[model samples]
Target: MSSRDTMLARIRTALANGPAPQPPQPDWAAPVHLPLPDAELAVTFAASFRRIGGEFFYCETLAQLGAELRAWLAERLPDDQQFYVWEPTLQALLAEAGVPFQATEAEFKAQAAIGLTSCEALVARTGSIVVAPATASGRRLSIYPDQHVVLARPSQVVAEIGDALRAVQSRYGTELPSMMSLTTGPSRTADIEKTLVLGAHGPRRLTLFLLEDDA
Candidate 1:
């Protein structure tokens, strides 16, 4: 009918048989790690996580993992609490484990203050999460959510920070993504009166799951 309407129709027709549009790229780095003593890597990862702004828990198998997650969530979130889940594998696992979850990219930014997921490795040198935000959804889920749960396999645990950085440069190339967050722990600040506060701008509870297979 109108010029605008005609243009819209033409565009739709042009793209009707074309591939779907790809989502915008989100900011993400490979995966980062925190430094801990060789003998105390496990305990340090669990306790000092909050110090660096993270939370920690453990699980040997997927079933155990589910139980631990449920317990941690039950303690923090209320009965009516609604959370967003990222990763298809994670979603499937949750479903298989009978864990109630909602998978919505939009919801990730709506009610989530932090996102919980696993990483390729944890640099014992620098506490960081190597995120790959090639799409906006990955970035949104981690940052938007208030509390983030990270699952780190023992094998992925590195010894130094340089190794982590090098890993990123290699994984994504020299040109880093738009966003690469190196989260050592929960977000905190002591600028005001030098008094530390958790969840100041990010997740207050930073939980970690250092999974060990041989150990």
Candidate 2:
């Protein structure tokens, strides 16, 4: 037999003598977990997020959140700049506070400078925000705007990505959302000359308003 044929025969014999390989397990079957304390999680997430140019805010109550929102808008946005909010509860809260925001998709697309929405979970391990299509206002609201603001409660924060996934599964059960997004910091890229550029494909800024319970 030729040398190549001899080598092939030896490989075949080795394979025949060895045990069959098992199929890989599904993600849900063998999920990984890493938990953290709530206080440590918030601190770690804030530090990691800020390192990538993300802004963070903490509010003790809805009233404080509204006040902060108004102050931020006044300082950062022009009077004519349009803002969009998707969540109904948030919409009501802002409307009650007399914050001008667009509710219709048409108006939002026409003059949207900032888009505010709620997230499914906040991952403390990677400093990421998990947004599912069904829970959020719309897919485009998070991607098309110049800036994205997330309204999250302290209870929504999880230790890691796996824990976040578990939370989604537990919340939605079999009727999961069509899509889920894990966003970390602002959209940026360092593809050209190794110089970092923000807003390469999506929102240039990411701000998180984390609501805490009254003490």
Best by TM-score: 2
Per-residue lDDT of model 2, residues 36-115, tens digit only: 66778878787767876889998887778888898888777656667888779878877876677888776666677898
Q: Write the per-residue lDDT of candidate 1 for residues 165-215, one digit (tens) a residue.
A: 677678778677776667777778888999998778767666677655642
- C-alpha lDDT (0 to 100) for residue 1 of candidate 1: 100
Candidate 2 TM-score over all chains jointly = 0.79
Listed in order, each prediction's TM-score against the native is 0.68, 0.79
RMSD of each: 20.1, 6.1
